[model samples]
Target: MASTDSHSCVVYLVDPQDGKKGTVVPDRFRRLAIADGCGVVGLESADEDGGSQEELTGLIVAAIAAVMERQDPAELGGDGRAKVGAVAKQAGFKVTKVQFDEAWPKYVDGLGADDEDKDGE
Candidate 1:
């Protein structure tokens, strides 16, 4: 296993059955996460020039736990779309329902992908 080095990585410590909320994972401990049940988005490791290295592209954005949920697109109409879209749109693409639906589960590094296909829920 690789140690948590200068290059950061988000570690979402999540519990799907729990409430939905996020918490920060410090840079030093960011690279550390244990789960087939969490979402991790990488940020760029800032450099002296206010940018990061080309080689070190992904930095730890956040580390959350016991809170990641498999978001359903139908639930977007109420209010959550804005929150999810912020991240999806940041990728520099037009945010659409189809795209968001596909991307939501992957955000958790396949945590939601497992049982969804098997249980037919």
Candidate 2:
């Protein structure tokens, strides 16, 4: 998340109480915010090439899938998490492992049973 200052804008899942923000907010939250008519605050970053929500979502998913594809699930450990973070960055999102871990559950839950079953959950 970028520093909260006069110029900085809040993204999707900003906790209002503390004013904490995340740039790579989960799609579920983003959609709800928009559907509820909440204003979206976007920051202009020199590194970021602004993109459509669908495109960005595809990029993020592809990055994760690519990393998972190269590793056996049983063998994936801390290194796997690191690889995911790196892959996300390569795809243009500055995602950390902790952030990914936190947001992933929300993203998964939003998909519900159909997606979960596909994952053998």
Give all TM-scores, in the order shown. Answer: 0.23, 0.30
Off by over 4 Å in 1: 1-84, 110-121
lDDT at 83, model 1: 45
Location of the lowest summed lDDT over 10 successive residues in candidate 2: 1-10
**Candidate 2, 12-119: lDDT as tens digits:** 456766676634445545533332334434645443333333334444555555555577564356644425545554454555565456545544554576577889
- Winning candidate number (lDDT): 2
- For residues 14-92, what per-residue lDDT tens digits would candidate 1 score against the true structure? 5344544444555444323321122343534454322322211121111111112335454234644324344333332
**C-alpha positional error of residue 102 in candidate 2 after TM-score superposition, expressed in Å:** 7.1
For model 2 the TM-score comes to 0.30
Which structure among the candidates has the greatest TM-score? Answer: 2
Candidate 1 lDDT: 0.36
Q: lDDT per prediction?
A: 0.36, 0.49
